[model samples]
Target: MANELMIFAVITALLALIFRFTSLIVNSRRNRKKAVAFFHPYTNDGGGGERVLWCAVKAIQEESPDLDCVVYTGDHDASPQSLMDRALDRFGVKLLYQPKVVHLCKRKWIEETTYPHFTMIGQSLGSVYLSWEALCKFTPLYYFDTSGYAFTYPLARVFGCKVICYTHYPTISLDMLSRVRQRSSSYNNDALIAKSVWLSRCKIIYYTLFSWMYGIVGSCAHLAMVNSSWTKAHIEQLWGIPDRIKRVYPPCDTSGLQALPLERSTETPIIISVAQFRPEKAHTLQLEAFSIAMKRLNGGKPKPKLQFVGSCRNKSDEARLQKLKNKAVELNVDGEVEFHKNLMYRDLVRLLGGAVAGIHSMTDEHFGISVVEFMAAGAIPIAHSSAGPKMDIVLDEDGQQTGFLACTIEEYSDAILRIIGMSETERLTMAAAARKRAKRFSEQRFYDDFRAAIRPIMCLPYRNSNDVISNRDTDEERVCTTLYTVCGAAISNLFEAIHKHCVRAVQRGESSSLSWLGLRRAEYGCFVKFSRLLQLNEFLYKVSKCGKIFCWSFST
Candidate 1:
């Protein structure tokens, strides 16, 4: 009996020590300088996402000049001046000041090759570790995630930072679940997995579980900014924080493109395709459609030259580009198809100036910035007939058709043929309308909307809230969230429901609102704050039900 008491005393002392240590990490929130840290692991990808990062940094610099801007990147060669120059030279976005860089070493963990089987969950969890490396090095007043890494937000909250993320698209969605259930082979679902019923069922279950965890972690963000209408809806449904979600269009470089003339040169009509060479972009589909279009011409009409222009982000992308070149050769349209990789803004503009139309074939693209760019450049877009293009961009402008939307390869080929057959007057008329429609997604509009969304959160106090709504957690507050929340019942998403329960319980005059330091006398024997719940899943559900005691609660 004496030994049992001694063991109990040791356990109590251990919990106290851990609680104090976690509190120090949580309470040490204030930085010497008021700074904003943008968590973007890959900064030199030269994609639309990278453009967004630079534009966002520039916007923040303008909004609050006193706040220092820092970019957490994995690129070893990246410097303040180099990134600034890339922004200007590549995307024509000029930064007011250089952002401080924090180099990350654990980037490999987030790479797709690291976990070939469970890539989605692998990368999601990997991002949490990467964020850990980033935040430990420099604790900022505001933690901004330009890249869509939802899993890292909870850890950032634990470090007492106000988390904000500009989500391009949801990490998981009903569409993914549907695709798996239907056994459809797409970018994420493997053809092999789709063929086997058992495999498909197993994957569906895995996705459902991951979706729940993703929703929980994603809710930790103080503000969630989405890029498109499609993106907004998915994030709203998935994260279950519709109140905090804001729909902001991505910054399209329309201002510069709008300056180009609508009239294409009398040379061969060029059809340009611009997007990163990722699997989902469907570069092969564009190539196949172009090949069919070329065959259909057969000396009857002038065959338009197809131009493939984009950047390769990694080895997989580089390999994909090479495979595309090989595919062009195999398709016998090698001579007709031209590949121009990583072209500068001026070069791309020059190509856009000569192009009669642009082709995009990615299905369910959240927001097609490239499609908008195509329209802004006076190129009638032939885009996929779903998501961003169909819902937002490729609609009637001033009572006239602005662009074409296609689903199948045959439909895309037909659109190409129609564009080639159009008279100069007809082409110019449509191009003019498309450009007018494109003006809505301009860089200035993004800056205005983005500034408005972040302003309220930037001014919020670093005070504790049971939900991941406000800002910093107090000394014991973070320990409860990180240790207990992770281990106990109020894991981010759990906090909001638990808080609401406690608030209702208190209003009923049943129980007092609780905190990490608060415990009901006699009924609760030990200082069992959430950071110490062993049977967290079971206990948390009871806590959510407002069962007598031990639930962490907040007034607001």
Candidate 2:
């Protein structure tokens, strides 16, 4: 009887392994056939959103060969040496860059280095044309909004393509509203009018308007994707778009972050921070907190050494880093604080592994990748109490905090001090908890979520007939087409004002003024030519916008 029982248990275990393996294979197969076209504004810069876009493309390509992952982007003239190019290769996604985008990148460089007044007419014009071309070519384009919008949306619609956007944050919020109002006060009286005018015309106004507009487009999509639940709710509430918003958190490439079991050589503590040198990141706060912590913890022994590792791309970022260095000296923590840039990934990871804790000072960091990187490397995270990092990722079993969350300078300082004073066992426990928590956000989870979201959209029926424009048409068809072209163009041009800088000064979001002014002259010319067109009243009614000609009814 004992021999038979042992044989039976071995057979059952074998069967279970087979079942699990089969399930994984089936899921992998399912994830592989979704064709997705990604629209990235700049082909050059390697920012966080760009990273997300590339990861999704690479995952799709690896798992599903038939799933066409076409990347439509503005050319940034970025070479293999360029940071973005390296990331793109690391993911294995093919790229399609437009000349206009390249020119835009060139113009940005010029604006940065040489001429401050470089309007970049070529860049803007190239963007519009490329967008128009992308719309005409690609069927279902997914827009990633790290770059500006005005050029991308209208073209996508003209071609009858669906758009899904991964918005980092809502452009218009309580924060932006206050800023717009404050700026509008400087404009000649008519505070409400000026505010409204600025809001409608300005960059922020355009951003907010485009976000809501894109939300409408996102709703129309077979799928609406976002990074966090916080962003999902904000999009739904603000846009009032009745769509299914799916949460697919982007992944961090944490291939080899497991503990190496190497001995840490330092007798004193080590705290390190890794982020781009930016004012918004509030690296100064980390320095301030560290200064206080070191002073309090100092007992005639060598104090903890703090390292700041990150690159400075812009002048403002470089300036901020310099300012922080100065402040660190003033606080008398100059000897403890060290700033280094452009460190290799392995080196950074090794540093993280040796560190007692990692510091993050950025407020409301949307889905903190660096914090997770630190966690994966077994660094206990001491982060600001912000939206993405606080609510989404850092949580432990039994409802305990995974690591420290601080808001005020004193609170931040105290948290660092407390961590420093922790017993070795307590520190180890916190590090373990952080690592466990970060496991959920691994590359596998990201791949699974993204695959599921994209699968349905890929299965959508290809309606080639409706999208194609034929030369022959009936009188009624001609009239409808005319109306569509005239009205569509008018509305699109009106909306394009949301992207212009002049409009950013006004607080009102995307006012009719810019649209109206543009159409006024066009309307007069159209009135003379309307008699020769196929549909007169039908054309007039559809094209007319408050006595101005609205041309968008053309069938393409």
Candidate 3:
């Protein structure tokens, strides 16, 4: 009796799922307005990622005014008007379209507090849950992730939304695996792992497994865009998707910076570092390097002053800034170091124009927009000798070095000393070259590349639109249907095999017919796999129920 009841409940649930899915298909065929939904938790954060989000939205709005845009944000305190104002004030970007903001309460799961240890794996799993929440709230024709959350792609696809991801940096890649395996004395490898053999082995295993999982998740995206050549290489290697990743340089406000006077005041050389106060930015290295450079210039030469201009997103960032100040005092360069947090756009432009050179110490920075801005403002750049600066930005087309690259504090000090000692004519020549290189990553170029990359996907007709279905969507639907059909057929074949084996065993007058089948292990494995499939189906059913409740609430 219990077995019969269980079977009945399973059948009923399956029937309900089928009914709901059929209803959704019918609803999709209706003439509804289509929109692209952008999933970014911290849209108001004044960072490069925010710049990409706003620019992409603006580009889409300008290019196609018919389609609407909706942004899923975690910033619930700010209204649409305030967000628009902040965007304009911080980045000089104007968003003509007022996108609907859907506040997500579960976004805290992605924050560092949720994962004080093992942040990478924790945030990744958290993003999957966040994506599910976004989907349950509203289903869009296209799902776009400006942030580096590739884990959301599969969830988007399961809901029949095309997935597009702009990967600022890959979460896991070969370089990360190599760093763990080799136990190198670099920022990528932990000091404990590098020192202990057992810890190093365990970390290597951890990174290798995570890399495989990352690749699997990354391959689910239909299209991927990266910010720099270094990012593009890593994405292509780890994403395991051929010809899906393209390079679209992040937008930089070059015109405004370029309009500033090229000639800087030589009375007191100002060395500026325009980056967020994050541990990865290596502000400590900048302080130590500046101290060493000052010591080198003590031979009857005026010391250059270092200015740290950056955005502070939260209390942690503010605390980091204070700690950096303390470090400067420890180095006895506090008198020469100045910290500027969240400077206005105009003030930042003015500072950049008056500065002689810019310094960046982040390792493997994925496309240094600040470095590009420094160049556009006629400040020669001295950046870390890896990633974006090494592969894309600082190199000249004619095989000339546009700026300086350093790996160590001493190297950074020597580079700064060399820049300080250079003739004004040489400095001007280098600045001109750097500015010319930066123009390639201008806002216009970014718009063009972004449009080209997304055009093929966005132009496809949505299911809810009155327009006829494009070949791409039709092909995708056919492929998805065939996949389901194939899976169903495989399950049927497995059951049939078990049935035939059981019949043959019973006909031979064997009491233990299950053992006679010689397929108990295979049958158990199949049952486990099928059970997982049912659990996934059940989860999707619950999500669909939530979506229905939301839709009903909005309609009433």
Candidate 4:
């Protein structure tokens, strides 16, 4: 029965391949324009990622009038005109050429709900499916993933498209592995690890194996552009591909912020935080830190107020904002805390200019564009002690700390107190130093770096209809193509099963332990087959550790 099922799978896969090839041929013949496709599912999110997308598209459009740009987005409700208007109003990025939008409906597969057990691996696989959907809808000469979905690189290569990626952060890192290993008492500690030593070891093994897979996917990209030094280091280390990753600091609109005068009254010092309402941004931490800081400054007349200004991308973000408001009230600082959603660019600049300091609480942030913006606006920055803020932005470059770095709420509170207590001259000096450091990540510099990174890839010979069709004439080529298609489809089907099981589990309000174990076994079986077919012995050896980990998790 198993052999018959295998044969049936192969037959159906071949038929699907034939249909896909025929469609590709037809699309290629009909759509003759050589274009670069930007694969960013949330292009209208009004976040830093969206800014990067629009800026990248604008840079490509400016480089050549002949080269067209296409954006693959999951914002199905928004029209291209609305996106353009939002981009201009929010980021001040004007598009010279209107980008053709390819709306993808299957983006939810990559969401958190689809992968309850193994989020990284599940989301990575889901991204491959989403990329496949985009590729089928509109084939582009160069495929650029601006949303940090490195798993799409191999699929892009299979389709004969040059791959470029602007990675904001690595999907898997040594830090993630370390976190799994560390059984800390903090709220952030892994529950499985905290429960049992055996489970902790199993999770470590799982993370180690997933890191290997993540590296393989990342290495497939032709050019990997990272947004910060921290990101560059992680990508280079994980991908094991040195010299290929370039640091392209994200564009921060500093000119407008810099235009505002640095002199501001500190009678009622205002601390501001500018970041989207994402979980990783640590909005809760920001609120807690602000509350702590307020308590420390009780004796000071007219205590400093905290303002949270950021964009909300979806209903979840709105919910997060409401929760934050409740948290502020719980801390008894609700009256002093102000929430501003989707503030206009000019208004944000005005607030930044008036604020005494900017606070960012997210640890290991990829690159705090908001922190840089704060510095450019002459707002003293108080950011977390790791990642971009510590390593790149708030450095003691000129023998002086440009901004403060804190790790705990007490530390953040102390930093705020220091800023509040500083004299006018001392405050201005630090603010000037921060402003000087921020110039390194200006929009002009980003344009130059981005253009330089993409120019060579854009110059590469594009695979035309004839090239794609002729390349598959050989038997080996055809076999490999078929196998790739079959492997991708198998993986997608496995993910679909897992997704459905997770949905059913959620509806039933129970753990889908049996379904999860079955799916994990099937996934391992598929991985073994794929590795053997591709003759990736080393890769298989590394990935097999995950099977052992799965067994341990199942046993537990």
Candidate 5:
């Protein structure tokens, strides 16, 4: 009798669990709104990524008006109108209307402080948890992840929503694996792990496992839009979704910035460095290089001001910014250096108009929207000679020299000294070339590529033969050959006038030193699949031409 009672209880518990699971699936499927819900928690990050988010929302609004846009956010103060205003003020993106906001209580779980160790996997799992909360509260027909949280794709799938993600970069890559195997110490790989072989081996194993999981979850996305060729290559290698992955570069505010005069104010020439105060951004290199240049400047040359402008994401970022300020004081060049935190669009435009040159230093930057901005604003760019800037943005345009590229402190300092030495005519000529190249990354290009990439996936209504096929046609929605859905409204400008894009500056080593940038597949260390990038090196091996202060056209 006792055994029979126990069996009956077990059966009842199993039945209850199944019933609950079934009800959840049914409820989520039935209650979903026909809209695209963007999974972006930190809306006020004020980076190029956030700009992409607002632009994506705008693209959806202009193309399709039937579906409502919803943002899944951790920021408690967010409202429909506030987000809309931020889009316009912070990114210069004007939305058709206010987007619906879905706030999440479990945002702390995704915060860096929540997991001291294993932050990558921790934040990723936390994203899944946060996503669960988001889906449970308000399910949508389409789940669009603008923030590269690939881990949440499976959960979004479970909720029966079509998954689409705009991947800025792969969460884990072969470079990380190589870094572990080589015992290289960097932000992600600590010195302790690098020093101990056993720990390094254990970490390699961990990364290997994580990579596998990341690949699996990433492949779950129905459509993947990558921001650059570098990102596209990596995502294809990992997700193995070659057909679905589309390379649509991030949008740049070229039109707005293009209006800024190429002729600068003759006052103290400003050299602008725009980027977030993050470790990977390598802001210290820019400061160090600036000090070196100051020391080398001739007595007759006027002192140029080095302006560091960017946003702070968290306490760590603020601390880093403080450290940079303290470093400037230590270098005794504090008087020559300036720090501008969180400036608005109009103010940033004004600053860009006055700047003679801009700099960027981050390594392996995929595609630099900020680099495009500097070029658009007629500021000479001295960018890192790897990935995007080398392969895309800083290239010579129309057979004219566009900007400089460098890698080390010595190279960057030399570039700065060269810029100062150049005559006004020489500088303006290069700036004009850069401005022309910046047009390639304009917002219109992003809109066209974005719409084309998602057209088949969105499954919009067929266009009639009478419809206009021009790219500039705003009324294409009425007789739309293709359409995408996602949108929001403008509130009182929450960001006020705070919209500045980052353009991290660094220079390349000599030609021999840059040989590694063009490595063969087998020579690419742990990344043997890099054969696709072989042609990138062919673009140019820079040769000193006409003793000019700038490098020649990269892709013209």
Candidate 6:
């Protein structure tokens, strides 16, 4: 009887091992070589972040077939295969996207939960689970790019995979912080209470968390990649990271931007502004600068009509435009300045094809993708002399003295007027110089730089002696990882639903005759402050319920 029992136990143990090994084999079968995954919160509109993500994808695929690219974006319905196909063909890079997950930014439940994944936690539980599943299926080397999502580093590192950050720019700009503080004081009435209450929890928490995360991941990562020298300096300054951050300037498809044979007519000198309408982009400042320049040029010489072409991303930006139009009307330059939002790429290229000068006003914009786009079209770029432009756009010897650097409203006005008065020979010379400089940021160069950044990491050995794990992880971990990921996603969705309903309930009751029953204006103030103990209890319940769902599913 004792012998038989021992025999049964040994057989059971052998079966368990067989099952584990089988799972491992299945996962390893799908794992890819030299693969890195890129995560972006939103995928719909192509922006600077998207530009960086796509460039690396193209480079990795071209340089190393062993490398695979996985992109996580917020465009929920986007067909990953189709998106990847389109991007790869256009950019000369082969790539694929992971099944996208929907993430709403303003939705309280999602913002609080999903935001933390990239910030403090290297990876969100859901992201890890999904990523793990992908690894099991493909076994690609997992390299992460933090340029897209603000948070996800902690969860990423915890998974024990190599990560490469294509850091475009720091999240918190000192200028942005000062503006927020100024606005907070003016609107909140009680300065102390306003600063305490309305100073934006997202900015403070997200920036501090991401800053810390960047330091942590940056110090220990397999590799660090940055877009511009300005960004590298910024990262080093902010994080005090001793290690050198590898520079990979985001590629601009300059092949198309080669000098077109369009004749320069001195009759209608066109001034162009190409940028998405955001407060940061400062379209208002562009309008004001143009108005001031036209005034300065009013020696009865017919001034150029200023054309502002780009899409507006926010309602507040649109409203700001209307106010600027009012200013234009007040200044009597309304007809001379045109605001065109949402231009097709081809149309924009055509517009740049005609324009003589390109204008950008965002202070220290990480890397001005549009600025180079303008130069590529043979338009002389007179960009703000800060951030990425200072380092990337101009030659050190001449740029330091002759480069356009506007610090104030008056300075921008002066720069525009000065550009207008330059002789055709001078303008053409500057335009040629700008175009020549823009060539350095071409797609091919970008790919080469990106390959250089990850070559060392990709060369690392896998457990398999002969074969390297260039792209992803082993099979057994993948199976468990996927199981946990699917479960976590379901939970996140459930929590999001609950949070929406609770916030909605509070809002709907606002019109009720019973002031006490609904959230009074005061109770709706801050999540940190509520009047009665029960109200606090109710708020906590909602936060906890939302947090609980997030924690439970994400923790898996």
Instruction: Please tell me which predicted candidate would have the highest lDDT against the true structure.
Output: 1
Per-residue error for 117 in candidate 5, Å, reads 1.6
Please, what are the lDDT tens digits per residue for candidate 4 over residues 8-59? 4575466456555645534543364578889998875667888888888888
Which run of 10 residues does model 6 get worst, by summed lDDT? 527-536
- What is each predicted model's overall lDDT from 0 to 1? 0.82, 0.57, 0.78, 0.78, 0.79, 0.58
TM-score of 1: 0.82
lDDT of 2 by residue, 79-167 (tens): 33353455544333333321112122223422333432222323334455665444444444333333433334444443344455566
Error of 5 at 41 (Å): 0.5
lDDT for each residue of candidate 1 in 1-556, tens digit (9 for 90 to 100): 2233244446546545655545444334433136899999999787889989999999999998989999999999999999889899999999998899999999998998899889999999899889888887897878899999999988787666778999988888898899999999998999999999999999999999999998998998889999988998888888999999999999999999999989886358889999998999999999999889888875767868999999988999999999999999999999989998999888998999889999999989999999999999999999999888888899998899999999999999999999998999999999999999999999999999999999999876655322332333544444444554444432434444443554455456543334232545323334333334544465443332221111222111
Candidate 1 lDDT at 272 equals 95
552: Cα error in model 5, Å: 54
Superposed by TM-score, candidate 2 places the C-alpha of residue 521 at a distance from the truth, in angstroms, of: 25
Best by TM-score: 1
State TM-scores per candidate. Answer: 0.82, 0.66, 0.81, 0.81, 0.80, 0.64
Q: Supply every candidate's count of residue pairs whose N, Cα or C atoms clash at under 3 angstroms.
A: 2, 36, 0, 0, 25, 37
Model 2, runs deviating above 4 Å: 1-37, 41-47, 67-75, 79-85, 88-151, 174-222, 259-266, 300-302, 398-400, 465-467, 471-556
Between candidates 1 and 5, name the one with more favorable TM-score. Answer: 1
Which rank order by lDDT, best down to worst?
1, 5, 3, 4, 6, 2
lDDT of 3 by residue, 314-413 (tens): 7778899999999998999999999999887778888898888999999889889998998899999999999998988888745655889999999999
